[model samples]
Target: MPTALTAAYILHTLFAGVWVGAVLLATWKVVPLAKGGDLGPDALRSIESGLTTLTRLAAVVFVATGGHMAATVYGSEGLFGTGRGHLVLTMLTLWFVMTALVEVGGRRMRSALDVGKVRTAARDADAFLKAASVAGLVLLVIGGYLAGPAV
Candidate 1:
């Protein structure tokens, strides 16, 4: 592989890890704390802000690097017809789903947190965040499948 493409792959992998890890952390840890009133409004808002920023950054990087890889490796004709192309498409769909989930959930949580309703914020955001977490995990699985057998 070319150096540029290799670099793209490396960046793509790193961002994917970060993005998914954040989602999982929010779902498994942050939400529970908020629901239990263990976290303050300021802290929750900060976390939500951080997650939003990370999600936005990851989305841009994923689109740029994934698009470059698809164009370079699959080309126009290969994307629609190949198995790998289909996996890429699946990943793209999941990416959108995860992003949207986070945005919607974060907005809901933030609004309630602004009012000092920690439990309400957690309740409102819980389902969306959980779904996003599941989608993120699925994306990783699909990514591994696309990677094929390791050498």
Candidate 2:
């Protein structure tokens, strides 16, 4: 493979790592603390802001590098045809869904939080966030499997 393609692959991997890692950390550490009353509303809001920044930055990098890599390597048919391609497509779809969930949920949570109703909006949505986290892990596992010597 060309040096440029290799670099793109590495970047794409790193961006995915950023996204998946942030989500996992939020689900495991932050969310639980907020839900368990260890963190107050202001703390949760601070976390939300920081997480939002990371999520948006990672999303841009992930999409740009992933699109470039997919186009350079497999193009359209390969993306839609093969098993590995299917995993990529699934990741893209799940990424979209999770992003939308975060965007919408964040907005709603922020609105409620603005009115001092943090627990209802944020903690209640932990279930959805948990599911998204599990889906993220699944995506990582599939990507790792595809990255094996077979592919």
Candidate 3:
């Protein structure tokens, strides 16, 4: 049977995959629409709504699974004990903060979209995407480290 830590690792890996996938999907779909030509008020609003919904769902899954994984893996000592632990904790912190910002920005964009304010919504969405991308990259690095042999 898998240990708690092993289970946590699997859960964390799944959450990270979903989180990164959502961000990339939105970036691919929306960025081109924004750049290709003006998406206009209606199309942009629709895009914003769809992205906001997708992001919120992804965030919920990430937070729930990640919290459980963190508790199992880090426990009382936190993720700061050894070098690997410290690196994991630092990366997690960065991703958490960035994800929070993305949530806030996503909410703002949703509101703007509701009002048919395409430009404002697009701006907020852009900010959210950028932050999410950075978070994803950090997560990827942390995952790579976790997969490597212990020193």
Candidate 4:
């Protein structure tokens, strides 16, 4: 059980980091480049495709590992009755927000790209991507706080 819990934590943290990093990069670098005409539509589409894949993969991993850890650490009681539990709940909410943002942003970008509208796609997706980036950072901070020695 200990080993399994450890593994779960490792996976959860790693996937979260990867997701957040990708969002940050896309929000800060990719979108700007695309908007500025520095990045071609083909390249932007490729990046968006890769980001979508990573986002979906990370979301699945996060849910599985997070559920296991929550079940193990808090049992049923730890869900809503404690401070850590609140943080976990918050993280879960942010996770959903990030996932939705990615989905919507990807859809917007893909549709525009499909029509050969590169700048329009970038403009449409930028806000959602930026919001997701902020949410991802907050999730990481809360996760770190929850992982303190008290746990």
Clashing pairs in 2: none
lDDT of 3 by residue, 13-125 (tens): 77677767767766667655654556776776565566557657756765666667666666647665667767767776877776776677667767877786766776767
User: Considering lDDT, which of the candidate structures 2 and 4 is the better prediction for this target?
Assistant: 4
Tens digits of per-residue lDDT, candidate 4, 1-151, equal 5698999999999999988999999999999999998899999999999999999899789879999999999876788888888888989999999999988999999999999998899999999999999999999999888888775
Supply the global lDDT for candidate 3.
0.69
Query: Count of backbone clashes for each model?
Result: 0, 0, 0, 0
Q: Per-residue lDDT of 11-110 in model 1, one digit per residue for the tens?
A: 9999999999999999999999999999988888999999999999998999899999989888877788877787888899989999999999999998
lDDT of 2: 0.76
Q: How close is candidate 1 to the true structure, as a TM-score?
A: 0.95
Cα displacement (Å) at residue 47, model 4? 0.6
Instruction: Name the better of 3 and 4 by TM-score.
Output: 4
**Residue-wise lDDT of candidate 2 within 7-93, one digit each (tens)?**
878887787777778777877888777667677789888877877787788788877888887898778999998887887898888
Clashing pairs in 4: none
TM-score winner between candidates 1 and 4? 4
lDDT score for residue 11 of model 3 = 69
Give me the runs in candidate 2 sitting further than 4 Å from their true place. none
- In order, candidate lDDTs are 0.92, 0.76, 0.69, 0.92
C-alpha TM-scores of all predictions? 0.95, 0.87, 0.73, 0.96
